[model samples]
Target: MSIFEEEILMLIQCTPRAGAQWPDFDTISEKDSHALAAAFQRASPFPHLVMDHLFPSPMLQAMAKEFDTAAPSDWREYHSGLQRKRGTPPGGHLPPTVQDYFNVVYSGPFVRLLSRITGIDDLIPDPALYGGGMHEVDAGGSFEIHMDFATHPRTRLVNRLALITYFNETWTSEDGGALELWELEPPRCAATVVPHFGRTVIMEQSARAAHGHPQPIREGRQRRSTVAYFYTNGLAARDANDTLATTYVPHAGYSRRQKAELYLRRFAPPMIVKGLKAINKAARTRHTRGRGSKL
Candidate 1:
C-alpha cells in the first residue's frame, strides 16, 4: 500500500503512545482510543464501540462488490428456521481484494490497534475464521438475542472481542436488521445498531454481552456483514464445565412461536433439525423466488 493509504488507515484517532506500538496505519486517535478503552473497562454491561467508515472507502467498496457478486454456492448455508444465512470462509475462492483487507486485519499492525483500543493485550486473530468471515442474513431471517459461545472451538482460546463491519448501503430502520445489544440483569436492550454501510461495531464478548438481530429482515433486502472474533490466552474459562456452546436467551415480548422455535433448536438432534430446515427452505423457495437465499 502507498504511504498515503497507510496514513488514511490511521484516521481513527491514536495517541502518541499508541504510535510506539503500531507506528504505521492510523488506528483511532489517542483521545478516542482512551475513551474506547475506558468504556470497555466500565462495569456497566459488556462494553462496545460503534465506528463509522472503519476502513478506507475504496477498500470497503471493493469488499462490498466482491460479496454482492459472489455465487451462492461459494457460501456455506446456515439455516436454523428462525435464522437463515450464509457464511463463507476465507479460503481458496476469496477474491484478491477481499483477501487484501483480511490480510491487513490479520496482520500485527491491526492486532495492536485492537489491543490499544480495547486495552486488552496479546490478542490473537482466528486464522480459520470459525463462525467469522462473510455473513449474510436473508429477508425473513432472524437471530435471537443470546450470548456467544465463550470458547474457541478449535484453538481453545477465550473469545474476547467481536468485530462486525456492516455493508448494507441502503439499509434503514424499516429494514428490520439491527444488531441489538441486550442487558440481562433487568432484561432490556442497551443499544441498537443499524447495519449501516461502512459502519463497524466492536463488541466485547462476555457472559453479560447478550446480542442479536431478532427482527426479520424487510422484504427485498438482505443484511450483509463481515465478522471476525479476537481471542486471548490469559482469560479464565467462564465456568468449571468449560462449555463452548452458545447460550441462547429469549428477549421479552417474544411470541410463543418464536419461543418454541428457540427451545426446539436448543434441544433437537442436529441431523433432525438440519433436515427440517432444509425442507422448510426448499418449500419457501419453491413458492417464491429465493433471490440468492439458498444459503
Candidate 2:
C-alpha cells in the first residue's frame, strides 16, 4: 500500500472509536486534558487550540469526496468586499459524512469535553448551524479580518467558540488560505494556522478573537473546511458591547480609501455615520432597480 494509505490505516487503528463518530476527548486522560487546557490558555492572541490528525483520515477523505461531488446549487455564494466564498445554507442538506461529523462533535460528551479543555461551562450547539457548515473559497476569494457575531440571531445565545476542520489534502503555504489570528490593540496578525488536511482549530470567541483568511487562494486551488460555533446562555462582561453582527476591520494591506472608510465608521459621529449609511443604501437600491428595469 502507498504511504498515505498506510498512514490512514495506522490512524484508524490507533484512534479509539467510542460512542461518537469522530475522535472523542473522553478518551483523553486527565493529565492530557490539563496539558491541552494550558496550551489553549497560553496561546497568543487568544485562547485556542490547534490539533493535527484530529479526525480519522478515512472520514475526512469521505467528506472531501462528497464535497467535491456536491452540486453548485447546494452552496450559497457570498460575493462582497469583506468576504467572497460559498457555504452550505443554514439548516440545508449536507453530505452524509459531513452531517455525521457535525452530529458527533455536537454530542453531549464532546461538548462537555470542550468545556473541560476551555474552562467554559454550559456550552450549547446550534442545530441549525447558523452562519456555518461546509465552507469553500475558490481562487480570488477571501474573508477579511473580522470578529464574529456576538449573539445567535435565532436562539439569542451568546457566541462562545468556533471549531473549524480543514479538508484540503496536499495544501501548501503557496495555496494562501491560512487562518490568521490577529492582535486587536495594534491590529496585526499574531499567528497563522495553515489549512492542511486533518487539522482542526478551536478558538474562543470575543472582541479580542479577531481572525480571517484574507489572502486569495492561488489559481487552480480551492480551500475547504467545515465550521461549527458554540454558544452560552450568558454574555461575558468583556464582550458586552461587541457588535451583534460580524464586524470587519481594515487590514494593513488595505488601500487608503478603504482604511479611511473604516475609520469614518469607527470614529465618526453616530448621526453622521448613520446618515451616510442611509445614503449609501439608497444609492445601491437605485442602482439595483435600474439594472432590473434594463433586464
Candidate 3:
C-alpha cells in the first residue's frame, strides 16, 4: 500500500467508541495494528466516520462525471417527505452511474478494515445487497432524513448500515448541504458535516442515524460521494433475540403542521398503508401492460 493508503487505513482501523481518534499512521507496530482490527470486530461497536488523506481524491472527482442524474420527475410544489423541500433522487439511483466504484470499495481493504471495526464481517454489507449497487449523490441534490430504503429488493434482507464517503475540496462550514445527523432524544439537530473528501461517516441504520441536509447549494458548490448500504442475512432468518428494526424519525426542525401530516403517514392503519401500496403496484403494472399491449 502507498504511504497515503496505509495512513488512511490506520485511521479507520481504530474504534470510534473512543470518539474519533486520529492515529499516527506511520509509527504503529504490527502487533498494535493487529489489535486494532481485532478490537474492531470483537466489539460489534457502532460504526464511526473515518477521515484520512487516503480517500482517492482524483479518482472520486473523475468518477463524478459519470453521475447522470435526471430532472426531478417526482418534483412537487409542496414536498411531503422527510423535509418540506425538494431536488433529490426519489429512489436508489445516482444520475450518471456509480456501479463501478462500489464494486472496488466493498471488496477492497476498506471492507477488511470495516469488518474488523464492526466485528460483523460475516454479515458485512455486499454491493449485491444494494439494489442496482450503491446510489450516488452530488451537489444541489439533498436527501431528507429518513431510514434508507429499508430492504434490498433482490436480497430480501434488512439493510443494516450506511457508509458515506464525501469527496469535496476544502468544504467550508458555509457549504449549504452539509450532511446533518439529528439527535433522536428531544429530537434536535446534532452532528452536521461539510462532506469533505477523505471523510467517511459509517453509522448504524436506525432512528438514531436520522440524518439529512436542509439547505440549497450555493451556485458553485457540490457534494459528491459514494454510498454503500449493508444488510443482515434475512430479517426472517436472524436469531429471534437478534431482531433489530429501523424506525423512521422526522427532523424536529419542521413545524407542527408538517409533523402532524408526517405522523399520519407513519402510523396510519396497516390496511390503509397496504391499500395505498397495492394501488401503486397496480398502477405500475397497468402502465407496463398497457405499453406492451400496443403490439
Give TM-scores for every candidate, taking all chains together and pairing residue i with residue i: 0.80, 0.82, 0.61
TM-score of 1: 0.80
In model 3, where do residues sit more than 4 Å from their true spots?
1-46, 68-79, 83-97, 124-141, 234-247, 269-295
Q: Report the lDDT tens digits of candidate 2 across residue range 1-295.
A: 1111001111122246656446754676677677778888888878898887767788899999998888877898765556788999989999899999899789886798789889998889997899889999999889889989988888888898999999998998789978988887778887888888988888999878999998899999999999999999876633645455777766678866557666776788878866876786677669979999999
Pairwise TM-score winner, candidates 2 and 3:
2
lDDT of 3 by residue, 123-213 (tens): 5556443322333333454455554455555556666667777666787767777666665555655556566666766655643456666
Pick by lDDT: 2 or 3, better one: 2
> Which window of ten consecutive residues has the lowest lDDT sum in model 2?
1-10
Q: In candidate 3, residue 182 scores what lDDT?
A: 63
Among the numbered candidates, top TM-score falls to 2
What's the CA error at residue 127 for candidate 3, in Å? Answer: 3.4
Pairs of residues clashing in candidate 1: 10-26, 12-28, 12-29, 13-28, 13-29, 14-28, 14-29, 14-30, 15-30
lDDT of each: 0.73, 0.81, 0.51
Ranking by lDDT: 2, 1, 3
- The sequence of per-residue lDDT tens digits that candidate 1 reaches over residues 1-295 is 1101001112444322342422244545677667656655663456777767557677788888998778766798766634567888544356567667667677887788788878778888986787788888888887878788788877788888899888898778889978887778677776688888888877888888888887899999988888889888854733322447767776676778767777877889878866877897788667557656665
Candidate 3 lDDT (Cα, whole model)?
0.51
